[model samples]
Target: MAKRIDVADLNIYYGETLAVQDVSMSIEPRSVTALIGPSGCGKSTFLRSLNRMHELIPKARVEGKVMVDGQDLYAPDVDPVAVRSQIGMVFQRPNPFPTMSIYDNVAAGIKLNAKRMRTSELDEIVERSLRQANLWDEVKDRLDKPGTGLSGGQQQRLCIARAIAVRPDVLLMDEPCSALDPISTQKIEDLITELKADYTIVIVTHNMQQAARVSDTTAFFNLRGIGQPGQLVEIGDTATIFSAPANKATEDYISGRFG
Candidate 1:
């Protein structure tokens, strides 16, 4: 099931330096929310914090709350690994396990989490996940092939299959289509539209057109100057953010006037 996310007074820090400051937003369940900003604006940093992936960095930490279904994800005693299981992530590049077969790639997460599923059940899950990712029909006969043997787009969809195989409540994609060709990008966009019916999705994109095309809601992030922490400039329905943002900075950035 999809889950709603509430971020309150969230600040992200690397060592002693703050990267994102006081960002608070509510992400609706079963919807796609796109985060857009120029390079170095902390858009990806903020996305990583949602799943506690940010803390993987040395000396990194987050302040305030990231609540999913009313549970604070960062509260004491909450396990980061468990939090990640509920929220799956895809990266900027398609990174299939180079040595693993396509079938094994999709089954990896499920096997890691469930540890005791029968072979038949694992096969069923791999097929279901590949179908959900829209790649089953294309690769059904090649299940034993190396995942990296596919084209760039197919590899990305394979990664998506892997992500959804675990049945996560939310999916976080950080520039998921950035490395793909135009055709591949479109395929991923269409898949995102379909998946939002079952998973709350948060995507960070530098491509404004892609953001406008795939997202239901949009959040614009910006920084004051060099060394300044990134802040949430404005957020609203996608149409409003693209056409008539209330904040001048948002309008300016969206209009291509400045970053």
Candidate 2:
């Protein structure tokens, strides 16, 4: 089942320096939420914090609370690995395991989690996941080929299949379409709309129009000045944010006057 996220007084830091400051928001389950901002405003950093990916960096840490369906993700006994398994992530670039076949790429997470299954069971899951990602028809005949051999758009869909194969409750994407061509980007946008029925989707994008088209909720982040920590400027329904934002900064950004 999809799960809601509640983040309160969240602050992310790299060593002694704060990167994202005092962000609080509620993310609805089975909906798309877009995070938008200028370069270096911590939009990506904030996204990573949601799944505890930020702490992978040296000296990176988080303060305050992040709750998913009333379970505290930062609790002392909670395992980060478990948290990550339930919250999948896709990067800006399509990254398929270079050495693995298309079949193995989709099956990697399940195998890594030590879920023993017969070959037929694995095959069924790989097919179903590929169908869900809208890639089965394109690659069904070449499951033995290297995943990296597909076109850029096809590769991204394969990555999405891999992320969803484990049945994750939440999916995090950081510029998933930024590296693809227009045709590919449109395909991905369509796929995102289809996936939200089963997973909580959160994406960080620099393209304002893409955000407006794909998201149900939108959050804008900004910094006061260079080297300043980024903070949430405003968050609300996407329609209202695009049509009649209550914040002047949001208006300026959506109007193309400034970023």
Candidate 3:
């Protein structure tokens, strides 16, 4: 089972304007929790806030608490780097460090951020990371090759290898399959199911069928105003949400009445 992420009354703001409002949901561990909604619904924004990435923006602020396991991520003394190390993220696009070799790309997090490990330890970590990402069989012989030499799907998998190299407790993916072809997308979706046995996964996707296919729980968010925050419309098991959503807005959104 995946660990649960408990969010309470979470609100996100950029400068003086709010982007997401009063969102509360528990993300189950060892399973995929997907965030789905129309564009600009703040799914990506909310995903970033979980690891405090929103703090990178000049005036961005996150109110309320996000608890991973049993600890609050935004506690005054909490280190954002520490939070990120525990909660790894993959963007909508594959972002492997193009200049680095596949082996180095997978180990970058450990090499730069992780302070103490012997060379032997790093070798083991890199190998195991690739295995966990399901790319080892294909990339083992090409470890020295540049990350950019791989196909787009392989590049995305390389990114996943990097994220898992650090052994994160949670992995957040923002439309990870959006840039890939159907075969590549299926590869990633299968990887999600496989990875969940060891890591909790949260995904943001516009494809409802994708959500139903890979997610155990789904959360819906919708735009509010020109500048107001996007709000959580509904959240439940994939079966319940698709078969019989309780909220009218959810019904409308799922039924294709409006985005």
Candidate 4:
């Protein structure tokens, strides 16, 4: 099931340097929220905090809370690995396990978590996930082929399939289409629209048009200057953020006046 996320006073840091500061937002379940900002503004850094992926960096940490379905993910007892299992992530590039077959790639997460499962059940999950990612029709006949063998777009969808195979409650996508062609980007956009019906999705995108097209809500981030921490400028309904943002900085950035 999809899960709601509430972040309060969230500050992400790498050792002594803060990257994103004082971000508080509630992400509705079964919806798409896009994070947009110029390069180095910390949109990706903030996204990484949702699933504790940020902490993978040396000396990285987060202050405040990230609540998923009312449970504090930062609690002492909460395991980051378990948190990641519940909140899956897709990266900027199409990184399918280059050495693994497409079917194995989709089944990887499930195998990592489940002690045992019937082959029939794993097969069913692989098929369902591929279909959900809209890649089944294109790759069904080649399930045993290397995932890297597919086109760039197909490989991305394969990554999406792998993410969903574990049935995560939330999906975090960090520039999932940044390297794709226009057609591939559109396909991923359409897939995001469909996926939100089943998973709470948060995407980071540099493309304003893609953000406008795929997201239900939008969060704009900005920095004061070089070496300054990124701050959330504004967040609201997508239409309002794009058409009538209340913050001048947001309006300026969206209007192409400045980043």
User: How much does candidate 3 score in TM-score?
Assistant: 0.96
| lDDT per model vs. reference | 0.96, 0.96, 0.91, 0.96
Give the distance in Å from residue 172's predicted Cα in candidate 1 to where it truly belongs: 0.4
| Alpha-carbon deviation at 115 in model 3, angstroms | 3.4
Name the lDDT value of residue 227 in candidate 3.
Answer: 62
For model 3, the superposed segments whose C-alpha errors exceed 4 Å read none
lDDT of 4: 0.96
Local lDDT at 144 for model 3: 95
Model 2's C-alpha root-mean-square deviation from the true structure amounts to 0.6
Q: Kindly give the number of clashing pairs for every candidate.
A: 0, 0, 5, 0
Q: What TM-score fits each model?
A: 0.99, 0.99, 0.96, 0.99
For each candidate in turn, give its C-alpha RMSD to the true structure in angstroms.
0.7, 0.6, 1.3, 0.7
Q: What is the lDDT of residue 124 in candidate 3?
A: 95
Model 3 gets an lDDT of: 0.91
- Write the residue-wise lDDT of candidate 2 on 1-259 in tens digits: 7899999999999999999999999999999999998888899999998889999999999998999999999899999988898999999999999999999999999999999999999999999999999999999999999999999999999999999999999999999999999999999999999999999999999999999999999999999788999999999999999999999998998898888
